[model samples]
Every structure is written in structure tokens, then in C-alpha cells.
Target: MEKCRFHEVKVSAPSKVILFGEHAVVYGMTAVAASLDLRTRMRIKPHKSRILVNFPDVGLKESWSPEQLKTLFQHKPNTEILDVNYVYLDLIHNFLKTESSDLRMASVICFLYLYSLIMDEVGIVPMEILVESEIPLGAGLGSSAALSVCLSAGLIGVLHQVQGYEKSIFEYTSSSIQKEVCGFAFLSEKILHGTPSGIDNSISTYGGMCRFEKGNLEPVRLERNLRILLINTNTFRNTKDLVERVGEKRVKYPDIVKPILESIHAISEQFLTSIQEYNQDLNEKKFYKILEDLMDTNQSLLTGLGVSHPTLDDVCRTLKKLGIVGKLTGAGGGGFALAVLPPSISGKTVLVAKDLLETKGYTCYQADIGVNGYVIEVVK
Candidate 1:
């Protein structure tokens, strides 16, 4: 084990699911979402010259020099960097116009951008980071957002402790850290998805369930915990392409899509209200019904928008057979399917459901609800 030369810090960020409103959100519809326990975690260590990247779970590792990273960013102008609003895109562009691989370049640009503004208050330099994530990539679980939040919070935490900016970790709440992480996550998400509605990253960063309106995020309170099971179709969905397809549909079939969008918006409100009131009695029946309605709405709307993939349909059909209400999450097409497990469903039943899905080559996990967004742990 090459005597791991770096001290490590661990940070975890949550995954998200849109309970209601999908294709319609772009058309100004409201969406309800909750965070899942699936998380991305990163370990950072100080390094002199080399920036080492590792994804142990997938058996991938790479290293790059700072100069090479800068050049890489220059070549790929579409990369995203995070920092205070004061040092925005132009500053990053100027910095990147220098050499590197896509991943190294983009990661470094984002790391540096975050370090410059966040660490300037503390003062630190290049550190090698190894990131490991359990969250499935490109599965509409907000894995990228979780990664971004983890990186930003980890860097800021190290800088804060080193520079004496903060004395105690107890000073900041997880929710507070989530807010800061959201800023960087939002920036990174934009780089991935041209014009994301910001709901995915927001819910992933904050955890719990929320009602997202045009300009605000309202956290919903549930009386009893909700259990969700995520089934991965082992397929990737390109959010940007899906967004574009939805846009085209809006232009070509406004008459047909508009009503669906309006209905989604209304249902989203009811969903939020239901969660907030903790109506557990009606929740089992009503909640699943609402979820089914939302799924139907999403499938119909996404089908019209031409973003449904065969794999996604297969997973949905499999879940239906298992008696679980589920739908394709995020921009849809192909990715993961999220299913709501009724309280009446037993753990043994869930196992059977998982086995059936796996028999069909679908990967499934019992997702956690109300997970904490982001956290920084110091290992000295």
C-alpha cells in the first residue's frame, strides 16, 4: 500500500429523486423532491506537485501536474469552476488557458476555483484527493452534484482548520454546510446540464423532502419516515440531450403537453401538502396513488418529448410486476428508476422485489430518506 502519504478527510453528499414534476418543470411547473442516502465521498491529502485522482471502487486512478491541469481546462472551455461570485467565469477562463486530461483538468479547475475564494480566507495550496462514491454515475441520483458538494466542503474544511479561520467543527451545522455546498454543486451541475432547473442538486444537498417553486426551496415535514427503493437499469442518461428534447416538444406540441404540465404542477402542490401534514393514515393509499399519477404523467410527457429509453421502460415494467410504484427520475430517457415502497410491504417482500429485478439485470438498492446533505470529517 505505497504507505498512503496523505492525511484524509471524508465528506458525504446525498442523492435525490423528483417525486413529482419532470418534463413539465422546464415549462415552469413545480416539482417535489427528496434526498436519498446514496452518497459520494472524497478523501483529500496534501501533495507537493502531483494531483492524484483515484476511484478505488471502479479501479481507476490518474495523476496530473498543475500546469497540465490548467492546459486541459483551456482546451475544454466548457468545464465548470466554483468560487465566490466575485471571481467568476472570466477569471476561470484566464486561469485555465494554460495544459491536461478532461477529468483532471475539470476537477482541478473546480478545486482551484473553490480554493481561491474559500481558501483565500484561510490560505492553502494544491492537495491530492481520492474520491470514492457509492452513488451510481449517470443514474439520475445527483451523483455529480454530490461529488461537487463533497469536494467543495472538504477543501473548505481543511482550509478553515489550517488557517485558524474556525476553531471548532461544532460551529457549523450540517444544513449550513449544505447551503455552501449547494453553490458549488449548482455551478458544477450547470457545466453538466446546460440549464438545470436546480431542483436535483438542491434536494441532494439539503436532504429531506422539499417543494421547489420558481424562486424558493421549501422543506417538507413528514410525520413518518418514507422508504424508497432505487432500481438502476445500468444505463446512462444524458441530461442535456433530454432537456433539449423536452424543449423541442414544448415548441412542437404545446397544445398536447401544456395540460399535462399544468396537472403536474397541481399534483406537486398536493404531494407537498400531504407530506407536510404527516397524514400517515391517508399516506399509504394516497401517497402511492400520487406517486403512480406522477409516474404516468412523467412517462406520457417524456414519451411525447421523445426521451424515453427502452431500458427505462423495462425497469418500470419490472417494478410494476413487483407491486411497487416507480418512475424514471431526472430528465429521464435512461438512468435509474425510483420506487416508493408501501408500509405494507415487508423487508422480505423488498428482498424478493430486488431479486426479481436483479434476475432481469437491474441493480437495486434500498435508498435512505432524510439523509444529511454534506459533512466534513478531519483525520489528523
Candidate 2:
């Protein structure tokens, strides 16, 4: 492979939201998710022979030498394809030791892990990788997934330029590159969420609406556009804690919680049906009506699982007063709640809702459903 002539590569990935089926999605239920307007962007440029990373959100700046990083991986098989496994992670754990417990430091570890693995095939060249995020961290908005996707996509993008990727008769198209990026992001997520459902990374890498069922993803179409109001509670909530609490409830009250979970599953099905109806040019009002009722039921089920917090309830109540259909998305202890607007919702109504929620001590913003997934661009 020839060396790259380009000096820099920049790539951006959109944040994602779970429209329906968050906790339920993890439990073999169907879930609907969409790409958010917010994005996390990554810019990479060649430097010396060391890896340098910049994460401004948390005041993190670090650099690592190629020799220092390679010891973390047995770098097995010495194949053309890059491979990452437990040996590398164990080595990384020992390398970071105390710092791995910190989220910021852990992310840096993940970045280097992915960086070294991908760059191995193309040969490592020193470079500066900078990240900037518009998505709020720890809000169940797929921030980590976006970052991972961007890194994988950015590095692979640079590889394309270095090896003269498009000159061959057969080469990867944009879609194939997206899947490859998502694959690496999935591996990286295992380090972030332990056992992730893959929905987050898939949506983050692809940037569109998806119906995830039993660990599989299929693209779903939206008939008419739906505008949503994403209100961040600004309240810190641990997704691991929330997911554990729900599991405990299921264990203690199997008879009681079983039906509720089933109901939640049913609601997801209903949500899918509504989308199909809307796509078929059916009644828009009727479709949103189904959504409103399902939101009420789904939120109630989440509350039963002990994932609901005061702030989440406050979000629901505020939206309820405005007659807007809202529910907590993702893990939902006290992170973010979504208010789905009606098909005929007026700008005045949206503004009023935002104003009311903001006045009530929440961060309110607007996003749309059914949007483009991910794209790569050259930085000139």
C-alpha cells in the first residue's frame, strides 16, 4: 500500500435517541430509534510517530508512543486485518490502572485501543485526533457511540487516502464503509457498556431510523416527519444503576413485572404499527394518538421498574399539562425525557412547550425523527 498524500481527515457522526424500546429493547423486544440533530465531530491530522488525543469536554490531553501502546496488545496472528481482544484490554487496564476507573481516562484508553488496532494494517503514523461533541454526556444520547464511530470512520478514511483505495476496480462504497465503522464501534462499545445491544452504535454509525429486534437491525421508514422535543433533565443518572434496578424488580416480582414487560413489548409493537400506518399515508392524527397512549403506558411501566425519578415525573407532568405526549427515553432514571409533538403541532405550541419546560428548570431542545445517518468528508 502506498502512503497517504493527504494531510488531514475529518469525520462526523450524529447522536441518536431511542424513540421507543430502551430497556425493553435489551430484553429481546422490538425498539425504534432515530438519529438526532446533534453530532460529535472528529478531526485527525498526521503528526510524528506518536498518538496524541484531545478531548476538550473533560480537559483531557494525552499522548502515547507506538512502542508503549503495542505492548498492550499481543497483536496476535500478524494478519492484514486488525484484531482486538482481552489480552489488549487486560494490558490497557494494567497500563492505566487507577485512571481506568475515571470515565474520561477510560474513554482515552478506548480511543487509543481503537486507534492502534486500525492503524496497524496501514502502519501507524503519529497524528492528532481531536473530538468535539454537541450531545450532552451521560444523557443516554449515544455520545460514546458517536465518538467511537467517528474514530473508526476517521482512521479508516485516512487509510483510504493512504492506500489509494478507489483506484482499484473493486472498492468499498459509502454504505460499506459505514458498516465497517459500525463494526469497530460495536467492539469499542463492549469496553464502554460491557454488553451493549449494538443498537446505539448501529444508529450512530448509520444515522437513520432503525427497528432493532432480537439483536438485529432493519431500516424503517417514516411516512410523515415527526418533530420531537428533547428535554434534558440535567440530572445525572447512572444507566448501569437504572438497568440493574429494573432487573432486580423483574426478579423479585416475576408474576407482576412479567405482564408489565409484556405490555411494554406490546407498546413497541404498537409503535411499529403506527409508523407503518403513517408511512402508508394513513391518518396522521390517529397515528400520533396511538403514540400518545403508548407513551403513557410505556412510562408507567418504566416507573414500575423504579427507573423514574422526580425530575422525570416533572418532565412528564409539565408536558402533560401542555397536552403533549412525552416519555423518558433510554434508561430513564433522571436523564432525558422526550416530548413527541402532534402531526399538526404549531410553532407557537412548540415554543410554548419549550418555554414552559425551560422555566421549570430543564434544558429543552428540538429534534426531528427520520433523518440521515452518518457521512464522511475530506478536510481541506
**Candidate number achieving the greatest lDDT relative to the actual structure:** 2
Give candidate 1 misplaced runs (Cα > 4 Å).
1-8, 46-51, 57-105, 166-170, 174-178, 191-195, 279-307
lDDT of 2 by residue, 153-179 (tens): 887877777777773112344566666
Alpha-carbon deviation at 260 in model 1, angstroms: 1.5
Please provide, for model 1 over 1-380, each residue's C-alpha lDDT reduced to its tens digit, 9 standing for 90 to 100.
12223346777888777777776666666887788887888888878777676767656565667665555333332223442342354456555553323443555455555544555543335577787788876567677777777776787666656655454332566555666667767776665455666776787667788877774688887656677888777777787788887677667888876776777677677667666554545646766676567666666656655777888788777777777767777777777777777778888878988998899888888976766667677777
User: Where does model 2 exceed 4 Å of error?
Assistant: 1-4, 48-50, 65-84, 93-98, 167-175
lDDT of 2: 0.78
Please give me the total number of clashing residue pairs in predicted model 1. Answer: 5
True-vs-predicted CA distance for residue 354, candidate 1, Å: 1.8
Query: For candidate 2, which ten residues in a row score worst on lDDT?
Result: 75-84
